[model samples]
Target chain A: MRPDWIAVDWGTSRLRAWAMGAEGVLAEAQSAEGMARLDEGGFEIALLRLIWPWLDEGQAVPVVICGMAGARRGWHEAPYRMLPCAPVDPQSLVPVAAEDARISVRIVPGLAQSRPADVMRGEETQIAGALAVLGDFDGVICLPGTHSKWVQVSASEVVSFRSFLTGELFALLSEQSVLRQGLVGEGWDADVFLAAVSDGMSHPQKLGSKLFALRAEGLLQDLPPASARARLSGLLIGLELVGARSYWLGQPVVLVADEGLAERYAAALAAQGVQARLLPARACTLGGLAAAIGQLTTAVSGTGRKA
Target chain B: MRPDWIAVDWGTSRLRAWAMGAEGVLAEAQSAEGMARLDEGGFEIALLRLIWPWLDEGQAVPVVICGMAGARRGWHEAPYRMLPCAPVDPQSLVPVAAEDARISVRIVPGLAQSRPADVMRGEETQIAGALAVLGDFDGVICLPGTHSKWVQVSASEVVSFRSFLTGELFALLSEQSVLRQGLVGEGWDADVFLAAVSDGMSHPQKLGSKLFALRAEGLLQDLPPASARARLSGLLIGLELVGARSYWLGQPVVLVADEGLAERYAAALAAQGVQARLLPARACTLGGLAAAIGQLTTAVSGTGRKA
Candidate 1:
C-alpha cells in the first residue's frame, strides 16, 4: 500500500500544510488557523481540518511536522539534534505516535548551540535545503528574517550556525525608541539606506558611536525621518555583514530570503566586495522537507517496515 | 523690605532647593523628592517639605525654579522662549504669583525645536552657566547626562541646541537587548571604549550597522560583553560628536558633566580633533543659577520694586 503524506510547517505566527503523494508532488495545499490560534488540544483538530480535504474515502494519511510545532511548547517535544548532522540524517527525525490510532505524526528536531544557549526551530530545514541545492559546496549561507541565521555548510552538512537578533532590534528601534517619535509617517528610501549600508560596511568598528548622531543631526538640522530609518536599517545590516564576514573569508555567499530582503543583502554584499546570490526561501524549504522525508522513508524501508 | 530668596533647580530626576538670605548668600540647602516622583498635588507638598526647614527659621522666601519644573506637565506650564534670549531674560521667565501670602514663584522656560518637535527642559541652565563663564564665544557646549545636550552658543546667546537621547539608548541597549544576555559584569575599559569612540567618529555615517554586529561577533567569536557595552557607548557618543561638529568647527568646547562623563567626552573630543575643557556640572549649575538670579534681581530693581 502506498502511503499518503501531509507536510506541515508551523511557525510563530502562521501554519502552512501541504499534502504530498508518493511521487512527492504537491497534491493539495491548505493553510488556516495559524499556529498562534491553536492550543495543545486544538492542534490535532486543526491538523485534521487542514488535511481533511486531502483524505481519500476511508483512508487516514500520516502527517510530518517541522518548525515551531515540534518545539517543547508545541504539540509534542521533538528533541533537538546537536551539530555535525545532515538534513537527511535519519537520526534527527523524531517519530511521535498520536493518541488517536488513525493519525501518525513525525517531527523534525531543532538545532542547538550549547555555548550561547541558543536554538533554531525551523531554519534547519532551510539549511538542509541549501545544502541539498549546493551539493557539497563549502561556503556561508545567510538566511535573513526576523532572526537571521548565518550557517557554515561543509561536505553537505551544516557545521554550525549563529543567529543574529537583527529584526527584533529594528522593530524595537523603529517602534519603541525615541527614533520612533521622529520616524512617524516615515517611509523607506533605498538610496539613503544603501548609502548607509556602504558606510557601515566600510567602518564596522565605529557602529555604537554613530547612532546618537541620528537624533542630534535630525534635531539640529531637520534630517528627514525616512533617511533616519534607512540609516538605521543600513547600520543593522552592516553589522551583520561584518559578523558574517568573520566566519567565511573571501568566499561566495548565498542569501536565502524574499525579493525585498534579497535586494538589501545583494547591495550590502556588493559594498563589501563579496559575491552573493538570492535563493528563493519557499522553494528551499519545500526541497528541504522533501529531502528529510525521502531519508526517513529509506531508513524505515531498510528496517523492513511496510512501505 | 529685604526680600528672602529661594533657588531651585528642578532637573529630570531630582529637585534641589537652596534658601538664600537678604544678601543673596546661600543660608541653607535642602532637597525633597525628585521631579519623577511628583504628580499634580505631589509637587507643592514636596516643595514645602524641602523649604520647610528654612521657612521654620522665620524666612518668607520667594522661590525661583529652573529646569523641567518649567515644562508644561511639570510644576506649572512655563511657556517657552525663542532663541537668542539669556537665561535671566525677564520677559522669558514665567512668574507664578502665589494664591496666598507673600510667597511668589518663578519658573524658567524651556527651548523648543519647531521642526523635530523636540524640546529641552533643563540644559538651558548649563548653557547659561557656560555663557557666564566664557563671557562671549561662538562654539558648541556639550552637557552630557541622561539626556545629553549639544548646544550652539554665539555671542553669549544660545543660537540652537540638539538633545541626543544617547544615555537612554545605552541604558536600553545594555539592559534590555540581547546584548544584555552576554554582559556578565560592568567595569568598562577606557581603552576599548576610546578605540570604539575613535572608530565611531571617523565613520559617523555607519552608526546603525554596527549594533547587530555586537551580537553576531560576540556569539560566533565570544566577544566580551564589556566590550559590547563599550562599543555601544562609543557608537552613541561618536554620533553625538559628528552632530556636534557641524556646530563646533574646531572651536574650544566646554564639556559640562560629572567626572565619568567628562572623561568619556574628553576622550571622544580628542579623537575628533577638538580641544575640550571639562567643567564641573555642580559648579556650572550654581554659576548659572547665580547669573540668572542676578539678572532677575536687577530687572526687579530696575522696575522700582523694593529689594
Candidate 2:
C-alpha cells in the first residue's frame, strides 16, 4: 500500500521500516542492511531498495529515520543533542541528499550526557514514542537491550540517563569467553536465575569470581548448561539493575522491550518490589517517528519552535 | 650442561621447560605448545620437542610437570585434588606413560574447592614454589593472570581459595568488545588508572555503566586510547581486589606475578592500606616443581609421607 510518509529504524545490526498513511501504518518492511553493513554511499541504495515499492513516481516521500543511521559512521553524522532536552527535536532533524528525488530522508539526532559520559541513538526515538503513548511520564524509562539505557524524564524532557553493557557483556562472556563451553545450548531455570540475581545484587564486586563459578560449578558439580546460562544472564542483569538503582528506585518505571526480555526484566524488578509497565518496542519506535514527523510538520507550518 | 632432572610448566597457552641440575636450572626453553594446542597423545610430542636435548641416551631423567598439563582436558587427567591440603602433594602426582624411556614424566594435580566451586591447575604449583621459598608463611597468596587466584594458606596447606576472571575480562573487553576501538594503541596513564581503581573499588556494582563511559568519553571528550586502556585495567583489577578483600584484609599478601602485573596489583592493594610483596612467577613455578620433586624423592626414601 502507498503511504504519505515512512518510519525507518536503522540500528547497527538490523533495519526496519513502516509505511505510514493518514490513519496509521499501512505496510511494513525490514532488512539486514543496517548502519553497520552500509558505508556513506550505501545508505541511499539500501533505503531505496527497501522502500522503492512504496514511493510515488514523482512525489518525494519524507523518510524519518532513527538509531545508528544517525551515528558518526552511519549515512551522515547527526550530531548528538545534549541531554536535559526533548528526545526528538524537529529543528535537529538532519536532512540527507538522496540521489533519487522520490524519497526525502531526515535522521533523528541521539541524546548525550556530559557528566557521567553517556549516549543513546535509536532509543531516544523509542523514548519519545513511549512518552507520546503514555501522555505524561515524569519518572524513569528503562530500555533493555544490548546496551541498556535507563533514562530519567521530567516534564517531557530527558534529564539524564545511564547506559549499561549488561546484554553485551552477557553475549561476550557466554559466547566468546572461557565460560562458553558450559553455556552451550539453552534451557533456563527461573529459580536459578532469581538466586543468581540476589547473589549478583548483594556481591556485585565479586563479579569476576562469580562468573568463573559457572565453569567451576559445571566442572565440579555437573551444573546443567541451561542453569549455567540462566545464572550468567541473571548475574549480568542483576548487576545492571544495581547500577540503575538510582534511576528506578522510588520512581515509576516503564520498560520498553519485547515479550520475552520484558518478562525477564519484569520478574527481576518484581522480586525487588518494583512493578514495571511493559510496552512493545516496535510500537514505541513507530510512535517516536510519528511524533518527530508531527513536530517537523508543525515547524514547517511556522507554528512550532525548535523543540 | 646436563640436567639431573627436568621441570616443565605447561599451561593453557604456553609451555616452559627448565633443565635442572643439583643446585638450579642449567638451560631453559619455551614454546607456544600449551595444553590448549595439544591433546593427550600430542602432549608427549610437545614436551619432547622442547626438552629432548636435556634427556640422555639410557638414564630416564625424572620430569616434574605442573599446570594445565594436569587438567581434565589437558595431556592426561591428573584429577584435581580436593583442597584443605598442601598445594602439591608427592603421593597425589599422576605418573604419565611417556613414550620416551629417557624421561619419566608425572603431572602435578590441581586443587579444587567444593563450596565455592573453584579450581586451579598451575597456580597451585606457583603457591608450592612460593611457600618453599618463604618457609613457615601463613597468609594470603595472590596469583594474578588470566584467571587470578586468591588463596588463604595456613600451616603450609591451602585452607581455601577463589579465582577471579579479572585478567580474562580485561583482555576480552580491551581486545574484543566494543571498547576495543577506544583502547587500540600502547600507552598508559598511571594517575587515570589509580582514579579508576578507586572508583571501581567504591562502586564495583556500577562496572557495566562505568565501562560504557570509556566509549562515551572517547566519543564526546576525545579520551586518549592510552588513558582508556589504563582505566580499563585499573577498573578490573580494582574490582578483583575488592572481591578478594576477605583474603588480604589484615593478612600478609605475597603476589606471584611478573614485575609489571605485580606492580599494578601491589599499587592497587597499597591504595587500600595493604602491603603486598612481589615474587617472580617463573621462580615460583620452578620452585613449586622443585618442591614437588623434593617431596617425591623424600617419599621414595620412605622419609616424607604423602605431603
Candidate 3:
C-alpha cells in the first residue's frame, strides 16, 4: 500500500497524517508528537517515524503539510500570507530541506490580518476545503476549538476573522480555578447549560461576579458536579456569542467541528433563532489538504496525481 | 513585654499573628502554614510554631482568629453568620479544643447572604475593624484580593455584598494561559493600563476576543511584558467595576487593600470619576480583631486587658 503523496496536519498538541494514492487515502497515521513537542530538528525525525513504511525504495514522495509545523519555530518558517486573499496558494508553499532522500515536503502558509492584528494556521486549509466542498461560501465559517475562530468569506476569499479564547477560559476555570472544586464529573444538564448561556449573554458584564456563584452554590445548595461543568461551559460560550454577534447575526452560519461541540454550538445558536450548517472537522481537513494537493498537481507537470 | 492575648489572620496562603498587650500590638509574626496547607490536626501545630514563645507557663491566653481559620474545613468549623447582622460578635465565636492548656482559641464566624448566595470569611473581620475605627460607614467597602469583595454597609450592619473573581482571573490568565508568553516582567505602563480599562468597561462583552489581542500584538509588534501585564490587570478590574457599578457609582467607596492593589483600584476608579478612600488592609484586620476582643473583654471578667 505504498502512496504517491502525503497529507499532514501538524498542530500544537497532536499530529495526523494520511498516505494518498491516485484515487483516495491508502493509509492514515497519527502521533502525539505535535509541533509543540518538536524543536527545529525534531520535525523531520517525527515525520519520518510515521511515514517511513509508506516511502518507496528510491522515489521522493511529495508531502503537503499544514498548520503549526510551518510556524517560525517548526520544521521551517513559512511566513503567513496576508489575508483578503484566497485561503490556500500552491505558489506560496515553502519547501523544507529533509535529510531523508525519499522525502519532499512543502508547507502551506498561514493567514494573517493587520489592523486588529490576528493570525490563523491550520484553519486556512480547513476554510479552503469548505469552499471547495460548498462550491462558494459567502457567510461566516466557525471553527470551534481551544481557540475558536469566526471567519467571514466573500467570493472565495477570506475577508476578516476573529478568534476567541472561550474554550481555553472554560478549561482553565473549570479545571484549575476555585470553580474546580465543584466541577468534578462527566455529567451534563442541557437545561442548566441553556439557562447559564442566557445569563452570560444578557449580562456579560457580570462574568467576574457570576463565576464565584458556581463555587458558592456548590457549598450552599450542594450543586452537582455535572451542573457546574455545564454552567461553566455555557457561560463562556454565551459570552463568546455576545462578542461574535456581528459575525453570525442575520447571516448564514456554518460550523466546522465534531458532533458534540457542533451540537452545543448549534443549540446555543438555535436559542437566538439562528440555524447553522454543520461540517465534520476531519472531512474539512482532508478536503482542504486535497484542495492544496490539486494546486500542487497543477504546478508540477509529471506528478500524474488527481486531487 | 509579655502579651495579654493574641490575634490571628489565617488565610489560604499565609497566616499572620499579633501578640497583643493591653495597649496595642507588642510584637507580630507570620508563617506560610495557612489553612490550605494545614489539615485538621496541623492548624494547632502551625499556630503554636508561631506563638509558642509568647505563651506563659500556666495562664490560658485568649486567641481571636478570623478568616479561613474559621471555615468548615479549618481547625474548627465556625459556621457563617447570616447577614443583616453585625460583622463581629464575640458571643457568637465558636471555641476550638486545643491540647495545650495555655491556649484558648475562638474563631470569628464569617458572613453569608442568602438572596444572591455570597460568603465572606476574613473580609468580615476587616469590615468590622473598618467600622470600629470609622465609627459608622454607610457606603460600600471594597476588599481586593484573590476574591475581591464589594460590601454595602448601612448604619453598623452589612446590608449586602458581591464577590468577583477578577484577581483570580488575572492571575490565571497572566501566568498560566497562552498570554503568559507575553507577560514576564514587573514593569507596568499606567497609560496602557488606563486605555485597556476604558476598553473593558465600554465593551465588556468583547472580553473573550480582546484577551487574544495581547498575544497577537506581542507576536506582530513585540509588545512588552509589562504592558501585557498592565493590560490584563486593567481589563479584569474594569470588567469587575462594571458588575459592581451599583455598589460604587455615585456612592462613597472605601478600599481595604494593601498599598499596591489599593493604588490600582483607586486609579481605575478615578478614570470613572470615583475617588475611593484607601485604608491599609493590615490595619483593618487588626481593627476587626480588636473589635472582637472588646466584646470578649466585656463578656468575660478581664485579666486587666483593654481592646
Candidate 4:
C-alpha cells in the first residue's frame, strides 16, 4: 500500500513512529531519541532517520505527532487546550516548519487543568484514539502508567480528569524506601496483593503506617520478598482507586494502557465489582492521531494544498 | 562534677553520649558510628571509642544505652517489651559484657504493639524522657522524624501507637520525586503550608491526586519552589494528622521531637485548634536515660549488681 501519512507518539524517553498508508501501517520505526534527549534543531534530524524509508523523495510526508515532543521545551511549542474540549483537534495542532520539505509535521496539543493544575500531553492522543473505539462514548477512561490518570469523557469531550502518582509511588516504595528490604524485583503473590488492596481501600488513611508494616513484617515475621513486592503494588493501586472512586463509580470505564498495567488495573477494578473495557495503548494513539490526520487530509484536499 | 555514668543514644546513623555525674552531665561526646554501620562485635568497639575517656581505671562506669543499639539486629538482641507497659524498665534492660571492665553497659528495651505489629527502639526512650517531665500524664505523644509516631500513653504506660512515614515521605518527595523539580527547600511558606494542611486534612482520600497536583502546579502556575516545598510538607503532615486524629483529639497532646520538627507539629496542631505542649527531644532523652541510670545506681547500691 502507498503511504498516505505518518503517525508518531513521542514521549519523554522514547519515540515510536508508523507509516500510515491508505488502509493501514506500511512500516514502523522506534527510537530512544525522544524529547528529553533532542534539542529544537535535532527533532527533524531524528525524525528523518526513522521515517526516511517511507517519505517520498520530493513530496512532503504529513506527520502528526502526539506527546511531549510538542511541549514548550520540546521540538515545538504546542500549547495546551483547556478542559471541556475535544481530546484531539486538528485545528489546535501546532505546525512545526522544518528545514527540509520532505516532512510536514503538526504536533498535537495537550490538555491543561487549572484548578488542580494538572496536564496531559501524550495521553490526550490515547484518549482521542480510545474515544474512536468507543465512538461518541460517554464514560470514564483510566490510563495506568508512571502517572495514572482517571478521565471522565462525555460527548467526545473530557469533562474532568485526575492524575495519580500511583506508579511512581510503587517504584519509590519498592526500590528506594525501607519497604525495599522485603521486596523482590520480580514475582507476584495474588493472594497477598488482593488482601493488601482490600486493606488499602478500606483504610486508605493508614497508608503510611501500612507502608512501614511491610518492613516491620519482614523483620518480625520473615515475609517473603515476592509477597512484599505484590503487597506494595497492591496497596499503592488500592489507594489510587480509593482516591479515584468518584470518577469511575457507576460509569462505563475503559482501560487504556500496556497489557500488564491494564491487567493489573482491571483486576483491581474487578475486586471493586467494576468491569472495564480494555484498549491497547497503541491502538488508542493510532486512532487519535488518525483523526487528526483525517482532518488535515480533508482540509488539504479541498484547498489544493498537500497535508 | 566527676562522671558517674554515661547516657548514650545510639541510633541508625548517629550516636551521642553524655558523661553523667552525681548532679548532671560532666562532659559529652558524639560519633557517626551508629548501629547500622556495625556488626555484632563492633558494637562494643564503637561504644567504647566514644566513652573511653569517661571510664575510670579498673572500675566499671555504668552506661545506659538506648535506641537502635538495642534492636535485634543492632548490638545485642534486646527484645521489645509489650505495650500497656512501662516505657523504660530497668528490670528489662539487656546486659552487655565487655572485655574491658572499665565500663558496664545495659541497653534499654523498646516498646512493641502486637495488634498492629508496630515497633520502636529509640522513640520509646524519648517517650520515657517525655513521661518523666509530664509526670504520670495520660494523653498522646507525637514524635516526628523519619517515622513519625503517635503514642497513646496512660499513667506512664504506653497504651498503643501508630507510626506514619511522614518525615520519610517528605524527604523522598522533596528530594527524589518529580515534586523535587519545583521545590526551593529552604524557605517556609506558612500560609501555603497551612492551606495545604487544611486541604489534606479535609480530603485525606485524595492524597495521590493531591501529591501530583504539587508538580502540576509547579509546571502550569509556575509555583514558587519554597511554597511548593512548604505545601508538600504541609500536605503530608496534614494527612498524618487526619489519620492520627483519634489519638490527639479532645486530649492533651505533647510534641516530643527535635526543636524544629516539634514546632512544625505544634503549628499544624494549632491549626486544628489543638495546642500541644512541646517537649525538647534532648531533654526527654537525657531525663529518660537519667532515670534508667538512677535505677542502676540504686540497684547496685542495694543488690550489688552493676548496670
Docking class of 2: high
The weakest ten consecutive residues by lDDT in model 3 chain B span B298-307
lDDT of 2 by residue, A1-307 (tens): 6798999999888899999999998988899998878899998899888888898787788999999988888999999999799999987899988889888899999999999899999999999999998888899999998899999999999999999998889888987888999989867899989888888899899899999998899889999998998899899999999989999999999999988789889999999999999999999999999999999999889998656
Better of 1 and 3 by DockQ: 3
Compare candidates 1 and 2 on TM-score and give the better one.
Answer: 2
In Å, residue A203's CA in model 2 sits off its true spot by 1.8
Task: State the lDDT of candidate 1 residue by residue for B116-135, as single tens digits.
Answer: 34456667776777777878
lDDT score at residue A54, model 3, on the 0-100 scale: 94
Global lDDT of each candidate = 0.70, 0.91, 0.89, 0.85
Clashes of each: 11, 1, 1, 0
What is the DockQ (computed on Cα atoms) for candidate 1? 0.13
Say which candidate scores most in DockQ.
3
Choose the strongest candidate by TM-score: 2
Q: Count backbone clashes in candidate 4.
A: 0
DockQ of prediction 4: 0.60
DockQ result, candidate 2: 0.80
Q: What is the interface RMSD of each candidate, in Å?
A: 6.7, 0.6, 0.7, 1.1
Ranking by TM-score: 2, 3, 4, 1
State the lDDT at B190 in candidate 1.
76
Q: Flag regions of model 4 displaced more than 4 Å.
A: A1-8, A12-64, A72-76, A95-106, A302-307, B1-6, B19-64, B72-75, B95-106, B301-307
